[model samples]
Target: MKIVIIGSGNVSYHLAKAFQQNNIPVSQIFGRNESDLKFISDQLQIPFSTSKLNDADLYLICVSDGSVGEVSRLITKENCLVAHTSGSLPKEILAGNYRKASFYPLQTFSKSKNLDYKEIPFFVESEGEEDLELLKNIALKISKKVMVSTYEKRKYIHLTAVFACNFVNHLYARAKEISDSQEIPFDYFLPLIKETTQKIEILEPKLAQTGPAIRNDERVLKAHEELITDQEQLKIYKIMNESIKKMYEL
Candidate 1:
């Protein structure tokens, strides 16, 4: 199956490489950004890239939510099987009376690091049986953990992912900033963070949760307040602590 990726952002870059690494064919990559188009083209050794979306067996739209619909309308072929990599965007956006589907990989991407797609959950959907099977086959070739998700189920999963991954990563970023301001090495927290994440694999996060929030220790809370100067950070800490306490009935 000859695959093509639209957009050379983090999602597109990672997915394209995964496709290539798994021995799945990647024919071309499209990106509006000249640098992005060139980057993926050079890296994948499939230099037949364009700013416009040419024809392909599968068009994996990895553009931003703001641009996906407009871009899809402009680029897709009448008979091409189009799919978007977005989790939050509705499948109907890609459904234009064509063989449309979704190939959403639930993982973050960065240029420096290669992703292990085998471990990431792939939420795929299609309108027709043939198209569904094709998408499923393609997904299963790259990953062993492929799941068929309806539009509603995908929406729910995407929502939970935002809370679990994106929101939590944002918290980690804020923690790093706070640590930097205090002249503390952010790497010092990495081992504890890794353990926290790993513990949840064996136990529920609620069961694994620790610290003053779970303990409802007022003294520790007071100490934390002195460390953060930003009112918003302080508010977030207080709200999260309160929510944690309320969740476990601490």
Candidate 2:
């Protein structure tokens, strides 16, 4: 099916590349910035436009959450199906004369990092059965895992993802900061982090709990609190320690 991708940010960059790799027909890529559009156009060898947006079988809007409604209003195509890659936005936000849907990819996108689309889970929603099937078929072309999800369910998934991915990544950054303060290489925690994640892959996180908080080792916890002099880090440590204690009823 012919497609036109909107925006030139990380999601747009990766999605367009995946479509190109799969030999999908991309009529054009559109954006407000001519230079950004030109760069992506040259990188993917696909024609791009800053003013003129072509009509296609499907249009994927990969812009920011705040701009999705504004961009959707700009698409003047009458019959073409339009979808956004937002995890939290409902399909109703694309309300207009044309068909609307959501084509959310449940993974973080970075332009520099190559992603295996085949392994990424895609959550799709459509207004009609035909359009839904079309979205599913298109998702299947790039990903082995595709699921039909409603806006309500998708929002919760997005919320949990914030905890699992974004918050956890911040914690990793905090750990690196602690290590850096002591002149210790962050790599020292690599094995521990790897094993912690690997354990959760086969066991529930609650079942795999360990450390001073879970073990109710007050001496160790106190020692750690003393070692962490940074107020922000100390606050986070105490909060997490209390959370762990509550979780395990230690």
Give candidate 2 misplaced runs (Cα > 4 Å). Answer: none
lDDT of 2 by residue, 1-250 (tens): 6799999999998899888888887989999988878878989999999888887879999999999999998888788899999999998888567899999999998878999999999999999999999999888999999999999999999999999899999999999999999899999899999999999999999899888898899999999998998998999999999999888777
Task: Give the Cα lDDT of each candidate.
Answer: 0.83, 0.92
Please give the clash total of every predicted structure, in order: 0, 0
lDDT of 1 by residue, 101-202 (tens): 888888878888976788888888888889888888888878888889888888889889889988999899889889999899999999998998999999
* TM-score of model number 2: 0.96
Clash pairs for candidate 2: none
Q: Which sections of candidate 1 miss by over 4 Å?
A: 95-97
Question: What count of clashes does model 1 give?
Answer: 0
Error of 2 at 221 (Å): 1.2
Model 2 worst lDDT run, 10 consecutive residues: 91-100
